[model samples]
Target: MPQPLIRRAGSADADVLTAVGAETFVETFGHLYPETDLRRYLAEAYALDRTRADLADPAKASWIVEADGEVIGYALAGPCALPHPEVTPDCGELKRIYLRRAWQGGGLGARLFGETMAWLQARGPRTVWLGVWSENHGAQRFYARHGFEKAGEYDFHVGDTVDREYILTRPPVSFSTVTTKTALDEHNLA
Candidate 1:
């Protein structure tokens, strides 16, 4: 396949974003919820109006990956909203990162993650956080490889169903105290 194109998302792309968001969510976690619950969750979470507003928000950043002119994946980052005590206004959250099953294991997810992280830290390093389903071992390991540690746990609601989610955090790195090499090695980014 040709290399996928990754670009910043805008309000005009809301419909496509909404579709891909729902598709990827169902592809990954549909079995975990009841039919009605899953439908309700997807409708609320991937609503076109909500997506358009998020895309237009200056405080958030989103990127979409396309291959053959079709969106195959996306990543979103914004001000932290995780319900952790240590979270502050300056902190950032990686709200979502999803790629179709066909596109997995080809390093595209990592590339998308790197881009989102760069955007989150562009103003300077601050705490970065994410939430992953507690049962999703592969995702947990992936976050660990990126220097995130399990900081806490919370219940994530999907309609009437609730899922245990691990809140992973990457503490802010002060460049003054840590060398570039050390920081890179710490995050396994080098």
Candidate 2:
């Protein structure tokens, strides 16, 4: 397997990131969101121009996980206010965590996640949070495995029908908890 390159995204990487966001989301969430809305959301959220603007923002930090010089996944982290007192006045959120289908296995997801979390934690964020669609059980489990717990809150939308999401978090101080727990779990199983 070729080594996966992990680095902060540059302006040139925006379009690819945006495109991947749409493609991966659709592939992962097609069952929940209709094809039409999924396409619409992908286009709107990952449009080249919109993504460029986001990448250029001083307040945001984005990353691309590359393999053989091609982007296979990306992660976006930025300040956000949700999941109770926002954890900190400067708390950040894991706004996006995506990987192409081909890279979903092979340990790329865990590496990308670890890199993103390290970047955010280095910023001294009090809490890092993200929202996953209510139906994306796979994603929820992935987040949970990394110490993100549901915040017991749901975001609602009033579109053609109601849309809901669960807020999840990994506090900066809780890293040791996760590390110790994982070690214990592994020891028990062994």
Candidate 3:
């Protein structure tokens, strides 16, 4: 396994980042998100140009992980919409944390997640949150292991399927002050 370097992503890396995002999404959720709707969602959410814009946006923070000098994973965090009818104050969200299929299970996911959480922490957001489809048991388990607990429920449209997602959060997680040096015994890369 090659060493994966995690760094702050810039506009120049948008194209590869976008591609990584699409591939990761397809590999991770293709079965959960219908095939027809998958392409549409990927196109809309991860188009190269849109990713470039996002990297430039002050409201969003993104990072990329490279192995063998190739971008294989990326994570994005930013302000997210809360679905609760009862309003709450500001909270940071982990919009996406994706890794190419070949990169999964390598402890790279933990590295990316720790970095993203640290990034959000520096932004002064009180809580770090994200949503995972209820059916994505793997992701749910991952989030749980990282201290994210189910906070609420919401519905979304994926292709033609209406699905439920659990809103999860790590309360008052401060990225600037958090240091996650806890490393797992690496078994295999992906």
lDDT (Cα atoms) of all candidates against the true structure: 0.88, 0.72, 0.78
Model 2 C-alpha lDDT versus the unseen true structure: 0.72
Q: Scored by Cα lDDT, where does model 1 land?
A: 0.88
Identify the superior model by lDDT, candidate 2 or candidate 3: 3
Worst 10 residues of 3 by lDDT: 180-189
How well does candidate 1 match the true structure in TM-score terms?
A: 0.91
Indicate the worst ten consecutive residues by lDDT in candidate 1. 174-183
Model 1: lDDT of residue 111? 71
Tens-digit per-residue lDDT, 59-127, candidate 3: 898999988888888999887675854325577789988888887886888778878777777857477
Each candidate's number of clashing pairs is 0, 0, 1
Q: What tens digits encode model 2's per-residue C-alpha lDDT throughout 1-190?
A: 6678878998988767887777777676656766566666666667888889878987778988888877778888777756565567667788888888877756666666666666666645367788888877888987887778988666544222346788998767544444455455434433
| Model 2's TM-score against the true structure | 0.80
Question: In angstroms, what RMSD does candidate 2 have relative to the true structure?
Answer: 3.8
Error of 1 at 24 (Å): 0.2
Ranking by TM-score: 1, 3, 2
